[model samples]
Target: MNFGPPLTTRETPAQRAQGELILGFKRLGAVTKIDTLFQQGALKARLPRPQDPTLCEAVTLNISGGVAGGDALDTMVTLAPGAQLALASQAAERIYRTPGPAARIRTRLIVQEGARLDYLPQETILFDRFALDRELDIDLQGDAEFVGVETLLFGRQAMGEIVQSGSLRDRIRLRHDGRLVFQDATRLEGGIAAQLQRRTVADGARAVAGLIIAGPEAAHKLDSLRAVLNAAPGIVAGASAFDNMIFARLLAPDGASLRQCLISALEACRERRKLPRVWQG
Candidate 1:
C-alpha cells in the first residue's frame, strides 16, 4: 500500500578528487634529505638523487591526469635553515575545459634562514573554455633565497588547437620576514584571445612566462640577467630589479621560444647553479 516511491533508483554523485602534497627539506652538514613528505588523493611527490651533494630535488606528479571542474590541488614546500632544494613538476600541466566550477590551485613556499629554494615547474597548457584560479605565496626568512618561474600557454599550437574563450585568474605574493614585498594579480575572462592580442596586453603572443629571483645577489646580477633576456630570439622580454628582487617577463609566439628564453635567463640568475635535469629533455 505504501509503495508510492515504486523502488526508484538514485544516481550516485560523481566524486571530484581533492589532492595535496607537502614536502620538507633539512640540511645535515652539507647534505640535504627529504625530511618530511606527505601525499594524498591524486597527488604524489618523489625525491631523486641530487647531482650536487648539497642540494635536494623533489618532483611532483599528478596521477589523476589533468585538472577539471570542481577539482582542487594544494601544495606546500618548506626548507629548513641552511638547506637547499629544487622543486619541479614531472611534466607540463594540462587544464581541461570546465563545464561549471573553476579548477583551483594553491602553492606555498617557505624558506628558512639562509636557505635556498627553486620552484621551477613546467608550463601550464589551457584548453579552450578552460577555467582556472591559481595562487603562489612565498615566505622568506633572513638571507633566504628563492627562484621561481610560471609559464602559461593558451592552447596546444602543435595540435592545431587555440583558446578562444576561457577564464583565468592568477596571483603571486611574496613576503620577507613577515612583511609583504611583492604582490601581482591577473584576471582574464570571456574572449581571452581578443584580450591577449591587445597592444597593452600580450600583443598577439600565445605564450607568456614570468621569472622571479629574490636574494642577496639578486640586485648584483640584474645587468647580466637583462643581457641574457635581451639576447633571446623571437621573444619579447624585460627585466627589472627592485626591493631586493629581480623580475623578468617574457612573451613569445609559442611555448618553444618562451622555454628557450627562460632557460637562458635561469642560467644567468642562478650563476653556478644548473637548470633542473628534467628541463634538459
Candidate 2:
C-alpha cells in the first residue's frame, strides 16, 4: 500500500516525475471556447461551465499530488483575438525536499489583440530542504489585458512547518507586442528562513506575493488598487505603475492574511468581477 519510495531509496534522486500541459482558447463570434488542449504525464486541464458565456475558465489538476526534486513540469497557454479566459489551479502546489537536483517548472503565456487573460494560480508551499527553479514568460500582442497573481509560502503556518533551509530561483518576463516590458527574479539559497527574517529582507514574513495588471487601463487604476491594499492588516504591501502596467507586492505573516488582501485587491483589477469560483474552495 505504500506507493512512495522506501526510506532507503528516498535519498536517491527522483528522476521519473515529469509533467506537461498546453492549452489554447479563442473567440468565435460571441463566445470564448477552448480551441486546443493537450495533457501529458500528470498534468490535466478542466473547463467549467461559466455564468458568463463570453469567458472561459480552466482549472488544472496535478495528478502527481506534489513536486519533488528532479521533477520537471512545463505549461503553456495561448489566447486568440477577443478571447477571455481565466487560468487557475485546484489547490496549492507543494514542492518537497530534494536530495538530488532541483525541481524545474517553466511556463509561457500568449495573449493576442483584444484578448483578456487572468492567471490566478494558488500558492506554492516551500518545504525545508526544497530545491526549485521556476520561470514564467508572458507575450502580449496588440492591445490585450492581463491579470496575474503569484504567491509563495515558506511553509504552512497551520501545519507548523518551518523552511529552515532551502533554495529557490524564480523569474518572470513580460512582453508587449513582441517587445519586453517587464522582468523580475528572486533567488534564495541556504538558511532560507534566516535570510527572510532580516528586517531589510522580508521582516520575518512567512508568505510573499505579487499581482500585476497590464492593459491600457492598468495605470489609471493604481489609486483604487492601492486603496484596497491600504486597509489590509497583517501584511506590508505596496503598488507601482509604469508603462500601462500596475504592479503590487505584499509580504504577510501567513497565507490567510495574503489571501484576504488579494480577494479585495483583485476585485479592483477585475472590474469588480469575482475571482474564479475554484479559488473560493
Listed in order, each prediction's TM-score against the native is 0.95, 0.94
Candidate number of the best TM-score:
1
Off by over 4 Å in 2: 1-15
Give one digit per residue, the lDDT tens place, for model 1 in 121-189. 999999999999999999999999999999999998889888999999999999999999998888999
Q: Tens digits of per-residue lDDT for model 2 on 48-153?
A: 8875777789999888999999889999999999999989999999999888789999999999999999999999999999999999999998889999999999
Clashes of 1: 0
Q: How many angstroms is residue 143 displaced in model 2 relative to the true structure, after the best TM-score fit?
A: 0.6
How well does candidate 2 match the true structure in TM-score terms? Answer: 0.94
Q: In model 1, what lDDT does residue 209 have?
A: 94
Worst 10 residues of 1 by lDDT: 1-10
Each prediction's whole-model lDDT (CA):
0.90, 0.91
